[model samples]
Target: MFGLWAPERPTEAAVRSEIWSLGARHQGRPLEGALAELEADEITSGRAALLRACVAKLRPAKVRR
Candidate 1:
C-alpha cells in the first residue's frame, strides 16, 4: 500500500534493503529510531506497518536460520 498507482507491498528483500539503508543513514542508531525517522518523514500507516512486519519477520528470535 505504498504506491501512487500500483499500491503494492514491498518484498522482504526490499524491506531488508530499506532497513539496511536506513541503518547506514542513521549510523548505528536503533531500528526504533529509524522507524521514528520514517514517521517524522510522514510515512503512511500502512507503510509503517509493513516496515514493522519486516522487522518482526527478521528479528533474531524469529529467524529459523
Candidate 2:
C-alpha cells in the first residue's frame, strides 16, 4: 500500500498481525496465486504498510518439467 519513500514503516506488531491474517485467509488454500495455474487469477493486495507486506500481484509458479 505504499511507494518508495511514501510509506511510514509499520510496527512489528502490525506486521505480525498481517502475517497471521494472511495466514488465516490462506489456510487450506494455495495462497491464491502461488502457482502457475492461478497465474491469471485475481489478486489480493498486500498490507502492513511497509513491514511485512506481500506482493500486490502474483507471478505464476514455473512448471519444472
TM-scores for the candidates: 0.51, 0.38
True-vs-predicted CA distance for residue 38, candidate 1, Å = 5.1
CA lDDT of every candidate: 0.66, 0.42
For candidate 2, write residues 7-57 as lDDT tens digits.
465566665555455556677233341332224345333332322233222
Can you write out model 1's per-residue Cα lDDT over 1-65, one digit (the tens) per residue?
44576656778787777777766777755376556665667788667766776566546685487
Alpha-carbon RMSD, each predicted model: 5.1, 8.3
**lDDT winner among the candidates?**
1
The residue ranges of model 1 lying beyond 4 angstroms of the native Cα positions read 1-8, 38-41, 62-65
Positional deviation of 10 in candidate 2, in angstroms? Answer: 0.7
Model 2 earns a TM-score of 0.38
